[model samples]
Target: MKKYLLQSIRLTAVLLVLLCVVYPLIVAFAGGFSKGNGGGEKITKNGKVVGYALIGQNFSKPEYFWGRPSAVGYNAAGSGGSNKGPSNEEYLAVVSGRIDTLLKYHPYLKKADIPADMVTASGSGLDPNISEQAAIIQIKRVAANRGLTDRAVAELVVKNTEGPLLGMFGPSVINVLKLNLALDELKK
Candidate 1:
């Protein structure tokens, strides 16, 4: 009985070490060395690191397209949604405020023109992209601010748009940082 107990103890310790330490270390190293988008780092032009495509940024100007509503205000450290149910009064109040703000900036936009993604926070507060339709809705305001033709700005939006993952896994989206940087480049 004593010998059997000792064997069991040794087996438990070895398995724990392998599962908790060795397995995690192997995964970490493998992920670090793996290729494919470098964990979604943003590519920039003109030798400057702009922003990560995976994390959202706040763009309040009329000229730049806005990403989804961020629950934590685009804070990566606090990356989570409000978790409020759709029927919650607090959620309704928050959406109402967002709608008011959007209307103030875009008086020409009908209620239907405001995409659902625009008024609701994503599951993560750090979403870095917006639906392609959302970007299209903001094109007129952006063009007016930069004194460019709406058609010209729309072309830039098309240039920055990214299709669904693997061509079908997700909806078409536009990276906010990339689009804004391209807008700045237009002035150069």
Candidate 2:
């Protein structure tokens, strides 16, 4: 029993160091090798940092493409979803409000044409990407507002659309911030 007790203590100590200490150090080191060198990828424009590539930013103007609805109002520190299920009255009401607001801005969009992501907040409430369909749906309004051709804006959306992981998994997505940045560059 004493030998077993000693073995248990050794195992616990070893695992604690491996998991609690060494693991984090390795992860941090690996992150340093990544794009932002352990920090998030900063998206810069006109020699100024606009936002992070991995986080969402609120863009309400008609000329800018809209991103997913954020439950936390795009507050990164307060990132979270509404936690209400589809059947929840409050959740439905919130979705309804979003739909109404979207319609007000995009009078040409049919209810069915609105992508689900456009009206629903992602789990993180900081999703920087939206479905290609979501981006495409806003092309007309965005083009009209920016005084650009629909074809031009649609081409921009196509240019910014990212394929699924490894070209074979998940639906295509568009980083809304990146797309909007490209749009601004187009005007230049």
Candidate 3:
């Protein structure tokens, strides 16, 4: 029993150094090679920082494309989903409300045309990208609101559409912030 106790103590100490100290250092070092060098990749507008590339921001204006609804209100500090299942009344109502808002904004869309990502908050509640279909659905409203031709806005959407990883994995998605930024650039 004494030998077992010493083994456990040594194991705990080693794990503490490996998991708590070494692991974090390795991750931070790896992150330094990424876009923002251990911080988030920030986008700038007119020399002013706008938003992070990996986190979603709320864009409610009719002229801009919307991102996935965020259950955490797009709070990166507390990033999470609602945790309410489909059977939960609160979740259902929230989804219904989102559906109504989308229908109101894009009148031409039928219920079937709406993508699930547009109505449901993502698991992280901070997904910066939405399915391409979600962005396409908003083309008319965004085009009309911005006084730009639908074709032009559609072209921007096409330009902003990012293909799946390595063109082989996952569905194509559009980064809402990037898409809207491109839209603003269109106006200029």
Provide the clashing-pair count of each candidate structure.
0, 0, 0
Each prediction's TM-score against the native?
A: 0.84, 0.89, 0.88
Using TM-score as the measure, name the better of candidate 1 and candidate 2.
2
Model 3: how far residue 25 lies from native, Å: 2.7
RMSD of every candidate to native, in Å, equals: 2.7, 2.0, 2.0
Q: Please give, for residues 71-178, the per-residue lDDT of candidate 1 as tens digits.
A: 888886678888989899988999999998888877789888888899999889888888887888888888888899999999999999898889989789888988
Q: Give the residue spans of candidate 1 off by over 4 A.
A: 1-8, 35-48
Alpha carbon deviation, residue 46, candidate 3 (Å): 1.8
Ranking by TM-score: 2, 3, 1
Candidate order by lDDT, highest to lowest? Answer: 3, 2, 1
**Which one wins by TM-score: 1 or 3?**
3
What are the runs in model 3 whose C-alpha is more than 4 Å off?
7-11
State the C-alpha lDDT per candidate: 0.85, 0.92, 0.92
- Clash pairs, model 1 backbone: none
Write one digit per residue (lDDT tens) for candidate 2, span 11-58.
Answer: 999999999999999999999999989998999997999999999989
